[model samples]
Target: MKKIAIGFGVLTGFLAFTAVAFAQTYTPLAPLPIGEGGTTPDTYTLSSYLVGAIKLLVAAGGAIAVLMLIIRGTQYVAAGINPSAKSDAKERIMGALIGLTLVLTSYLILNSIDPRLVEFNLTLPPVGQSPAAAATPVAPTPSAPAPVLNNGGTNPSAQPVAPAAAAPVTITSPTTAVTPLQNIINARINRSNDYSVISNCMGNTTYDLCVKTDLNGDGQTNLSDIVLFTQKGNLFDVNQNRVIELANTTAAASCFFKMPGANVHAMLPRENWNQSWSDGGSSAWYISGYSCGGSGGITGMPTVACSGATWIKAPALMNKCAITNGYMNMPFGFVYGGGSQFSKFQNWVTSSSVGSAVDLRTLFKATFFRPIASGDGIPQDEYFETDDGKLTYATIAEYDLNNDGTADFNASGADMTAFSACQGGSASGACARADFNQDGTIDARDLNLVKLMRNDVFGGSGFTPLGWILNWFESAFFDPAGYSDTQIISYCIGHAAFERCGYADVNGDHKIDNADLTAFNTGAPLLDFNSDGKVDLR
Candidate 1:
């Protein structure tokens, strides 16, 4: 027994000596690579020194743990006769293994929690000064929808569509009644094929499968066009399989084959075969890999799922209409001067017959406006506690009915009624009380109606005009400022009942009171974060 113990001690000493020698000679703990270009950190820096120290400590700890594990494992093997000794050795081995694992994986555990945890920046700011400002967080840009492409065909990104037919067919009536598929067919058939410039060929210009191929002239060329195309059973054979099967009904293929005046044959560097597209009465060029429909096996178009906000055309009178949502000054500002004001989801069709009714609520939801962090940006006076015990921006400001510096009193029922009447263009006795304090014209008055209500008049409304509001009325006909009394009054004429004209009934509850006040008094005006010519809110 004594000999065995002495032998074990010798072996342990030898192993420890070997580990130390190996570490000193090789220094296995290499400097960590850092930064974007994977360059090693400066050795003189405190962070680098600390990292080096940590790496050394971890390597030493791991070595010690492994050594202990080996010692215990040897003990367990040697103590074959004594069951109690073997069990104790086994437990010690397990403990050593666990310690080694922890030592080696400490960085990984910290990183898994958060990469910042393992990172350190010990550099201090200069004396009597704060640290340099961090980079500003940019709001994420929304991705455009992907194009629906056909199967068994290469993308015609650079290639032009086939040339015009030998006898170009001229569309007689632009408003002719035809199937949606025929609409696409007719437009493509009529477009003059320009090889050098593909502008005249208006088949899926953006190729997002949204509206460039508006064959029915509905302004929106979506799944409905493809559904109608498939329904008509006159789809262009994109895949030259000599058959227009259900498999060939890909959105990409549908638009690709029928591109007006596209020299598809010349552009494609492959073995070409001549195929013909017969749209009942006409024959056009169908390139290789496309096939005309066979007599059978044509089912219907597959059900496709598309997600986006539904836009409806509001009356042109709703242009540059500002609405107060109680909390912020003119938060729900809808500038519908034309479709050009919208950042996304613009009207595709310009027809007077198709009344585009835009969904204002959905449009605002997707927008990234001035977002306020909890208990930040808002003024102390503007803060109010909600019924749910949560503090938020005040919904309503103290109404100074008579445009005084100080708030007159809590807004009353008569005050709200008078304001509503004034909004309705009531020029008579009591309604005159609701009149805003103006120097001369309504243009000179505050653009922010809430500011006018609170009597918190500033030279400028403090709102930096964003895209939509800036160009709302920059047209040749209307006033450049877009704040003429005539324009504002004309806007208020029909929209007094609606919230569009900045009526005090912000919550749309009919009667304005304390609850309505809860939506007033945000310290700042509305924001247009993306500069997309529209006011947005998170």
Candidate 2:
């Protein structure tokens, strides 16, 4: 009975121990906040769990070591008289201590090597809910070509070329608002007035001598056309009288020095060549009988023929006079009344006195006055008459009276005087010379034209005849001409007269103000002050 009770008690105690051990619920640490997208914990989460587990394991090992020491002490006390029992208890205690030491040492060593080693997590998010599996991957951006750094480094692949700089702005202004001074000057200077004398004498016997000085082609010898011979000189018809408009009747009635008919008998001795004869026939004539020693009869004083007698007409007389005097005859009728009577002309004939004349063809290789084509907005009459029956009645103005290529405006006293003289005259009188616009009268319009042309000429607006010619030459023979606002501004600032003369009158309304400045800024070539190929206020 005692043995049964003891066994039953032991069994009961074992059962109770087993029940207690099994009943103590192992509460697994509440899973850390679920990873993003409910996936398994990340390395950090797992590492944290491992650290907790190691701490728990160390506590458990320490508790087991303490329980073992207590049990070993009890066993040693119960076996106080037995050396083997004490020795066995001590051994068991030592084994428990060694096992605990080993477990702790292993944990320490593993933690020292890598704390994450103990962070073992068996928990995982449900299938199909992994954060990494649901994440959207990102694409990398394309890289630009690296700049070529000239340091001592390996060369890189070629890069794309850079774009070019922006082009200059092309500014434009209103043409209608601006006075067309360039066109006006071009028209005036390049008149096609066919002076028949130039055409007739071109191939004549006198051509060799005639072309030397007979430039303006009026069948006369004068200073204006002398440049035709020199080719490098300037010719300015300041008086505006080189070309004249004549009535047909007046042209026909005009008389010049002439030789008498071959049928006429000589009234005076041929030897008395210097003698004078006055004829009452409303005309002037030279003594025809004198052979004063030249190919043509000697030039003599005017003679009055006896009644029904023969008198030399003027045209033939001029030819004879030219031959005798060793000069070319003025194509205009001979001057009868003043100290000009029998004034010997020097530049007319091919006399040894003057140099040999150049051929007209060679001298005029380029026509200075190319007629603007018709329908170009300019009046047909703007050009001088051509031999093809095109009669242009426009008169060139004496705007630049000083003949300095630039219109001097108030600086030119001569221009002022002439303007005053013809300021109020009709088209038939002296005012005709100042009739710049050719409206058949010298009025405000004519003065205005002069003023416009003067401004253009001095302001370097390229409206003067010479300016137009040069521009035309450049465009025709070289590269096309280009003008800029800089050039116009440079001219305006360089010339003081331009400033005073209202150079800013870009729009011909005749006011100098902000509008002009705006026009200039917007690329008015006329505003360029010094022509330095740039546009700036300075």
Candidate 3:
């Protein structure tokens, strides 16, 4: 009876200790200030409290069992003449063992069922702030319904439809379908006053595909220009095979154009002028046996060359090539003859041609031919390719509103501010900046588009190209500034709400509840648990 009474007292003390520990409010050593309001006090969830109680119970039970064993061993030795005392000591030892086993067994069972049962979250965020605000200890809430996606993973509504046979090119006067190509051209054209020469071609409504070939200065892009362009092997085919390979490569391909210009050059598999004569000669040109230096050829002309090739001007060949390949004509003023042939092409079209006489920068656009369905029908002309090389409508409609040379989600407040400025506004030319669907208006539709792409990371993990550029420009060229802890917390809270990240909605069902504790422990690191800028549990 004495031993049983001792054991009960020990258990009661342990229970009291656990109760006190749980009831005590958590206090941070240095609490972070949130926004302009309150300090984010350290907080704990009910689940954490329960977990603490369980731990204390186990520790107390184990300690008592050890103490009982020691006492029984001592009593057994001392009670040499008293059998009753020996029996009592043995009973106490057995009881202690049984009780200890039960406590440990309960812990093991609960832990095995779910590690979260034993998990305790000590990190807490400030309350009553935006989704971007510091994280706070929140009880799990009810989960929301699963989000609906079109066509399982594919966006069928955004899929490009096949062009009708011999369909007349729709010509809306003064403007055409605001395509990715058009946007790129317009951006380049507006970047400099030197590009004024080609500004008239900005809104041309002649060809479904913009054509810049007026080789003879006839001011008309006829079939003759296309023939000349093809003859020069300038309109190279985009290697659909390479793009498909990239699509399967990884998520990075969805945003960055990884294929080198050389690979782009290799995309033209057919025998064309782009290829060297030694590999596979062009059928259009006959190789003459006579060398330019031999007898009948001119002093500077090549002896062994394509027949009648000298009759066509070099500028005409380049212009025709650009047009044939579904790009705008390369202006004569653009520097051409240095570096890798592909590099020269990129420079001539977009970068180096800035100060040149005739700037056709606005006319340059990438053309891709992607199949809509598997192994059926003709491949449709896709104007833009996503970083992953997918031919979806989202990829096509994506634009570089910030003019940072890459299209990606706007994650900063500055970007949001810019977007807000154009909302409910007239169809100013600036409309193209935020008008996602090119409907000539910036409204709810465009806002929703921004929301849809908020999580999109371009250039893959560890290397955010656009973000890096923006940061560099801000620090190096513009004003340098850093967000304070309060600002960071506020931004985090706002970001969570905007993205529907659900730090409190642990189950990801879009609600908070006790059930969510299970998900919170096991779920992906989608929230910033440690006040770091990144979304991670650690």
lDDT by residue (tens digit), candidate 1, 466-488: 33321121111122132321222
TM-score of 1: 0.20
lDDT of model 3 at position 416? 52
Q: Please give the ranking of all candidate structures by TM-score, highest first, separated by commas.
A: 1, 3, 2
lDDT of each: 0.32, 0.34, 0.35
User: Hey, what RMSD does candidate 3 come out at?
Assistant: 33.1
Name the candidate that leads on lDDT: 3
lDDT, model 1 = 0.32
Q: How high a TM-score does candidate 2 get? A: 0.17
TM-score of each: 0.20, 0.17, 0.19
Better of 1 and 3 by lDDT: 3
**Two-way lDDT contest, 2 vs 3, winner:** 3
lDDT of 1 at 16: 50
RMSD of each: 38.8, 43.6, 33.1
